[model samples]
Target: MPKIGLIGFGKAGKAVANVILQHPDFTLDFVVRKGLKQEYYSVRDFIGVETDDPALIYSIEHIDIETFLDDHPVDFIIDFSSQESIFYYGESAARRHIKLISAISHYDEKTIEFLKHLSQKTVMFWSPNITLGVNFLILAGRILKKIAPWADVEIVEEHFKLKKGVSGTALKIAEILHLEDEQINSIRVGGIVGRHEVIFGFPYQTVRLIHESVSREAFGNGVLFVASHLTDKETGYYSFEDLLGPYFQEKENDGLC
Candidate 1:
C-alpha cells in the first residue's frame, strides 16, 4: 500500500480523504492543515471524526508541511490546498523527493512558472479540475476546433458564489480552441458544484459541449484514479489529461465519435 499525505481540509480534500479511507491499496499517512499540532491520537478525530465506531483508532499525525518532511516518509502528497500553500511547500516537497498531485486552481503567472520549474526536480501533477468528464470535454473541444477552424468559440463556466474568477477548466478548454480570455464568461451563483460549456458558432449553426459536476465526489474519484497512476511516474510536470490521455485514445480507437 502507498502511504499518502494530504494537504488542506476543505470540501474537496475531505471528500478525497473519505475515498482514500475506503480504499485498500492506499494508506492515509499524514495531513497538513493550518495550525495543526505535531501529533494526534486519531486521524478521524483530528479531521472531525464522524464514524459510528467510537473505538476506531488509526494513528495518523498532522503537521504543517514545513515540519512534516523533517520526520516523515510519505510516498505521495495530494494537495487541494490554496495556491499559497503550494508556493510554501513546493520546494520542500521537491527536496524530500515527494510526488505531488495538486488540484488547486487559478494561480497567477508567476506561481504557474514556479510550479513548472519545480516540476523539473520532482514529480508534479496539477490540474484545475480533476473530473474525468471535464478533461473529456477538453479533448472534445480540441477535436471540434480542428474540425471547424473558422468557428468562433466561447466558454461559459458557472460555480458557487464563493468561487472567484473563471475556472481553470474553462481556461484550459479555451487554450485548446485558441480562444482568448474575452471569449470566456464566468458566472457565480448558489451552491453549484461546477458547470462548463464550450460553444462553437459557425455561419448558421452553433454547437455546445458541456460538463457538469454534480458532486465533489467526482473530483475525489478522479484524484484517486490519478494518484494510482502517478505514484511511480518520472520526475516531470503532468496534468490530468496526461494521465487519462491513453484511456481516451483507447476509447477513440473503439470509436469515440
Candidate 2:
C-alpha cells in the first residue's frame, strides 16, 4: 500500500480521488489548495479531504516547501497545482529526496533541468498527459521517427477555455515529430476535456494519429497506475513510456506489427 499526498482540489483532483479511494493499496493522505472560501464546492462534496492546510499536503510547508520536507515526509507526492507551484514543489522534492509525480500541463526547460538534476539524487516521474493510450502513441512516435526521419508533421490540440491553450503534452508530441513550436496549433473552446491530433503530410497521402480524452477519470486511472510502479524506483526522471515498457515489450515479443 502507498500513502499518497495529492495537491490541488480542482475538477481533475476530484475525479482522481474517487479512483484512489477504490484502490485498496493506496490511501489519500490529504489535499492542498489556495484555501478557497465558499459555502461549499462541488469537489469538496465528493472528496473527504478539503482544506487549506499546507502541513498535510505531502509534508510540503506552505511558506517554505524545502524546509518542511526535512521534518514531514511521505512515500510519493502528486502535484496538480499551477506551473509555478510545480517548480517550487519539485525543487523541494529534489532537496529532500522525495519521489515526485506530476500529472499537470507544466513542462518547460527549467523544469526539465530541475528534474534532471534531481534524478541524480531522487526520483521524479513527470508527464504532461499520463493517459496510457497517449503514451503508447509517444512510444510509437519515437519508433516512427527512427524509421521515417523526414515525415512532415503538424499538430492540432484542443482543451477547455478554463485550460490555457494547447497543453505542453501536445507540444511534446510535436517535439517528438521534430516539429518546431511555431508549427503547433491550439484551439480553446467551451468545456472540452482534452484532444490531440498529429498529422503526417506526405507527397502521396497523409497519416494521422489522434488521442482524445473524453473524461478526467481516464487520466486519473493512468496516474494511479504510474504511482503504483513509481515507489522505490531508481533515482531519476521517467516518462509514461518508461512505465509502460513491459506492455510494449509484450507487443514486441508477439511480433512487431
Candidate 3:
C-alpha cells in the first residue's frame, strides 16, 4: 500500500480521507496538527492516531523548513495546510527531494523560484481547484481566448463566508487568461462550497462558462485522484491537466472506434 500524509483536517481534507479509505492501494499514514489532543482526537477517530512529535507524526501539522527536514522519510507530502505552510513545506520538500502535491494557488517570486528549483529535486503539483471539470474549463479557456482575443473577460467566484483568502481558483483562471488583476472579483456569502464563472463579452455577444461545485465531494474526488497518481511517481511538477489527458485521449479515440 502507498502511504500518504495529509496536512489539514478541513472540509477538503475530510472529504479526501473518505475517498482514500475506499481505495485498496492507498493507506493514510498520519494526520498532522498542533492543537490540544481533544480538538483533533476526533480526527484520530476519523483517520487514526494523534501525535505532536514530528518523528512520531503519521501526518504532521505546522510543517516548516526545519521540521520537515528533521523527520519523515515520506514518499510524497500532500499539503492543504495554509499559504505559509505551503511555501515552507514546498521549499523543504524541494530541498529534501520529496514530492509534493498541494491545493494552494498563491505564489510569490520566491515561491515560483522554489518550484522552478525543485523542478529537478522533486515533483510538485499546485492548483487552486483540483476538480477535474475545473481543469477542463482551463483548457477550454485557452482555446477560447485565441478565438476571441478582443473579448473583454471578467471572473466572479463565490465561497462560503467562513472560507479563507480570495478565490485562488478565480485568480488562477485569470492568470491562464492573462487578464489583469482588476478584472477578477471574489464574493463570500452564505455557506457556498465553490462556484466560478468566466464571462467574455464583445459588442452584442456574451459568453459565460461557469463551474458550480455542488458539494465538497467534487474536491474530494480531485484530491483522491492526485493522491492515487502521485503516490507512485518519480518526481516533477504536475497539475490536474496531467491527470486528465487519458480522459481527453479516450474521447478522441472514441471517434475512431
* Number of the top-ranking candidate, with TM-score as the measure: 1
lDDT of predicted model 2: 0.71
- What tens digits encode model 1's per-residue C-alpha lDDT throughout 91-187? 9888887888888866788988988888998988888888878888888788788888988888999999998777888887777778898999999
Q: What tens digits encode model 3's per-residue C-alpha lDDT throughout 1-257? A: 55566666676776766565555665665566444343434443555534322222333444444675565456566766666666545666677766677776576777766766676787788777878778888777777899989899999888999877778888889888999878888888999889988998989988888889888768767776777777667777777877765555535545831
Order the candidates by TM-score, highest first: 1, 2, 3
Model 3 stretches astray by more than 4 angstroms: 37-44, 47-74, 87-97, 202-205, 231-234, 245-257
Evaluated against the true structure, the overall lDDT of model 3 is: 0.70
Clashes of 1: 0
- List RMSD in Å for every model shown: 4.1, 4.3, 4.6
The lDDT leader among the candidates is 1
Question: Each prediction's Cα lDDT score?
Answer: 0.77, 0.71, 0.70
Q: Report the candidate with higher lDDT, 1 versus 2.
A: 1
- Relative to the unseen true structure, what is the C-alpha lDDT of residue 115 in candidate 2, on a scale of 0 to 100? 70
- Worst 10-residue lDDT window for candidate 2 reads 52-61
The per-prediction tally of clashing pairs is 0, 0, 7
